[model samples]
Target: MDIHAWQLWILAAIIAGSLEMALPGFVMLWFCVGAVVASLAAAVGLDINVQLALFTLISVTLFAASRTLFKKAFMRNASTVKTGVEAMVGQEAVVTESLVEGYGGTVRINGELWSARPLGGPVAEGERVIVEQVEGLKLWVRRPAASLEVPLKKKEGR
Candidate 1:
């Protein structure tokens, strides 16, 4: 019984494809196709060097092509994923304690005390602050905008 080079290539192709199925990332599939192409080259009486070259060329071409094609056609990136406390942005919060320079403060948001830091300068305790952003485990807060506040006026008749 005489075994041929193309026969070995065919077996390698099958193994590569099976490995691809077991661990998927679109990675091994191209190599499997390359092995098949190499087998075809062997069948066509091409030299061993040429067949190996064809395998490498075909595998690389397929892998690179698929990377770009799949990324453009299927891959999606979330523009914004506001998870946990980050979703509380723009919500009003009450300062639990006075915020002083060189000292951190706490705010009550969603019935929870959150460590906060003033934006421009420190704010006093019992003041309303807007959550501007979150850094690490602390909240970056600022005084509530006047537009969002109701102005107090003196009544003409009291």
Candidate 2:
């Protein structure tokens, strides 16, 4: 009726796995793998202290290895495509309201009027601007260079 060391190590692994699911940090699961290695050490009749040391070494090494894998699997790459409003950057927009330095205005980008601010000097209404950044519900814009500007035809009345 005596519980064996390997059985205890296996139980610890199961507990670690369950805790990983409940907390979900993508961290504790590495310890579960270490516990499995410890169970193998115990099955071979290794000393308790030796099993503990092996567990610690296995867990830390696996964690380090996983970080590189995670970077390749989850992190952005140079060829990655952006979606949503993030896709608006570098696009051209029209100022719907004049933007004074340090003050906010409105711009129409992709057919939507968004609160906007200029990165440098003020932008006048109906002027063309380029989207520089998108922060929260606001936009950061800049005037297109002179070479990029197209002269607007004047209305007969004004």
| Top TM-score prediction, candidate number | 1
- As a TM-score, model 2 comes out at 0.58
lDDT of 1 by residue, 1-158 (tens): 99998998999999999999999599999999999999999999999999999999999999999978787777766276777876888988899987765777899998999999888788988999999998888988999766666788989997
Q: Which segments of candidate 1 are over 4 A away from where they belong?
A: 64-67, 76-94, 100-104, 108-114, 120-128, 134-138, 143-158
In order of appearance, the predictions have TM-scores of: 0.63, 0.58
Query: lDDT, candidate 1, residue 23?
Result: 97
Instruction: Assess each prediction's global lDDT (C-alpha) against the native.
Output: 0.89, 0.92
Clash tally, candidates in order: 0, 0
At residue 84, give the lDDT of candidate 1. Answer: 83
Which structure among the candidates has the greatest lDDT? Answer: 2
